[model samples]
Target: MPQATALYTAKTKRCEARKKKRRMTEPTQTESPDTTPLILDVDGTLLRTDMLYESLWAAAGRNIAATLKTCVTQWRAPNLLKHALCEIAAPNVALLPLRPAVLDLADAARQAGRAVHLASGSDQALVEAVAQRLDLPGPHFGSDATRNLTEQSKAQMLVERFGEGGFDYVGNSNADLPVWSKARRIIAVSPGGTLRHRLEAMGKPLEVVEDRSDPFALLREMRPHQWIKNLLLFLPLLVAHEFGLSVFLAALMAAAAFSIGASAIYILNDLLDLESDRLHPEKRNRPIASGALQIRNAMIASAGLVVLALTSAWLVGPPVAALTLLYMLTSLTYSFWLKKRRWIDLASLAFMFLLRVLTGAVAAQIAVPGVVMAFVFVVFFTLACVKRMTALARDVDHGKLPGRGYGADDFRALKVLAAAGIVLSAAAFLLYAFSGHSGGLYGSQMIFAATVLPLTLWLFRVVRLSELGREDYDPIQFVTHDRIGLMIMVIGVALVILSL
Candidate 1:
């Protein structure tokens, strides 16, 4: 069965090549002076654009309030605030930060007297824009709104531009393999998965070029959004009147240190999960998993991140430094053993949230209220539970959780656990608001804050929508964009301010 499957795959690939060949008019035996012979894949090859797409879509949703009439018109919007915010929100992706080595390769190729042709399955306009930015000469090949330049179309374009055995090709996917095979020198820039293994098995003359682990993937693996969980550390400082210049500086430094530390952990996690991540749906694009980033380099980046974080912490204060160390230690534990165990994993995540609150307290040099810490614990625990539930739901939707210790069957139990967490957290909040420490102002404000119940109900609705695949996969985004959720949040904030 395995042999047949592999053979069938190979046959299908061959058929794809034949169709591509049929699409093209014969290439000139003699080349035109203006034509570039070298072809580059756009998405992962020439420039990073996945985050850009995400940002665009996210912005579109955010702009749904503004009622964008057309795609081109949206691009024409004078204010690029949402665009800029999108970059900040998903730096690992939106920045489409170029890989240094690929730039070097392009420079080397250009210097060698080869013309660069940008060919991507993404939109032609995007490809053209990037090519222009990179200073590649005119006439790039890419998918258009009308005709997608993917699969056979991509291959056909390559063949048309560079006759069989005429040009060198650079690419990084199984989808690219059929076309890449047509190149005289096949540069598999970060190749892996079934494609890499199959090519190796076929004894193709392929040279693999990789950057340090993909910065984006490395960044994601670290779950930097979880750094927002560290914002809990800031709440204590905020409540304690630690928002002055010096205190703010300390908090900023602490946040920076934590972000760096988290990024480092991502480098390590990718190194550890290289094989498993490859099988994952979304994670497969990661530098380490895709072979675009080297494991050794990822390790080095990890070390650098730690050193930088600790050094920054030391500059802040001894107490802050100590707290940072604890956070780092906790993260290490989560990475190694905690992530594998079920309830323990969620507990560890909640604990990390609590520590961030402590770190904030240390940064502000104030003792956080116990009630505040308890509230953070409950809130973060609920969020953590929801994350697990989302994962389990995704597993059920997809029929498997290929990279994590989960399966489709776990979805029901996970959802129930998540619901319980939400209930407990809400109860804790209500308890804290009504406690003896709760001042008269706080007690009065509790009525307004009670509005959180409806908000929670809406959030629950959104989460279930996400599980049902209607909401965005990003939880933070889901919260930020859900109309009812955002309005409730605004009301909650108003109540908190009134109490303060």
Candidate 2:
């Protein structure tokens, strides 16, 4: 079976842009008769995503053992591997982002008594399923047990079925150039970069249907705003009062490495949450969930980001690299299994934050205080509960929580847990006021201790907003847009400077 290497992969498929009105470049004035079949490519033509990658992720996320077993047994045959994966975890056709332009075109053709066909490099079973989903009446073709049908092979199939220059084709990539060469008419739907010009180079009259995808979608998918959480990596340096260039650079390195690595994990989480995210009120709008980004492209980006993170961490020294790897492994574990378990998910989230602080200390060669670790654990645990509370509260407002395993009866326990966590975190913050580490490092320990008042008030406000369902899923991002959060942050920073 075709399989993903990672544990439970995430999928963020965008549908909005794929269905938008297209900007036509040139209309195809076809000379072909009504008897001619209108052929469509499944991946990136009828759908916004590639079925191969989608099913692979689906299998890895939902049916890992079956998929892995198939992979080990059928690794020699590409077609068999693909068919095996589909049997294990075929994507929900109803949930896939079917391109409206292509669907509309197919409908118009059908209304005119013309035949419509599905031809793709995806496995034959999947192609037939897609044709069945459309209820189209005509032939459908895909790669079989012995051969992968693509490029020249696809061109050959069309030639044998309809003769060279007898069929009309809709395609979106350079790989389709060979197929287009034999078609009487060509239609391009949201063609990849430079594909239009290349199609034009073929000297064939082209009908272009453009879907204006966000040019910066990949960056948005990386979620740069959430990188602010990595700023916590500097906590050890600040608390240690180590302003030296080497240590400062070390802290920055650790933070950057963590930021990139965390993004990879977030992408994984997004993929695994695809179906659930589609049901969510707010999460459905995310670039990945909304089909604003392609699944294969997201996977490629995630893999690249993982490499960048690990290489960067290695540059930060062995200890930092080890810690970064630990964080990533824990995050993947959380995504794959721990998240499905009660309380364990929240504890893992909190522990991840502690790992960040610990990595910072290791990178900067700082001797971390015990209270600092305690403060991180309780405070982040409180925030984790706050996140859950915010989600549950929204469920109360919306009547259902899409992906959460929690229900109405669990709400009271969640509140109690959050409340207890808040009280404990507050107690920890108070202890920070009297921490011997602070007094020894800061010039004005009293000023440093005074910062606690605003910090405590900030935490309280965060919890209150969560209770009201006014906070975003991510507290850090919510704080970025919150005036009170900014004010408290400014005051806290000023107080820290005075202490320094």
RMSD of every candidate to native, in Å, equals 21.8, 16.2
Worst 10 residues of 1 by lDDT: 87-96
Task: Return the lDDT, model 1, position 184.
Answer: 70
Residue lDDT tens for model 2, 1-500? 23552322322222333434232444658676576788899988888778877777778777667878988998888678888888887876666778888899899988987888989989988888888888986689998887877899999999999999888899888888999999988999877668878888888778998876677878887888989888888988877778899999999998999999999988988887777777677777777777779887888899999999999999999888999999999999888777767678788999999999999999999988887799899888878878877887777454445555565566677777877776777677667766776667678877877887787778888888887888998776788899979999899999988877
Q: Please, what is the whole-model Cα lDDT of each candidate in the order they appear?
A: 0.65, 0.83
TM-scores of the candidates are 0.55, 0.84
lDDT per residue (tens digit) for residues 1-500 in model 1? 99999999999999999988876756647654533467777666655333234334334333433324434444543224333434332222223446566677778878877787777765455566677778889578765444556667777767876687677777777877777666676777667667668667645567778743444655555567656655665777666655688887888788778777877876666554544465556666777555455444556778988999999988988888888888888877676557767678777888887887788778877776687688777666766666766666665355655435566666677667767766766766676677655554353746645755764675477557745755554577667677877777787677666666
Off by over 4 Å in 1: 1-227, 396-400, 440-443, 471-473, 481-483
The candidate that wins on TM-score is 2
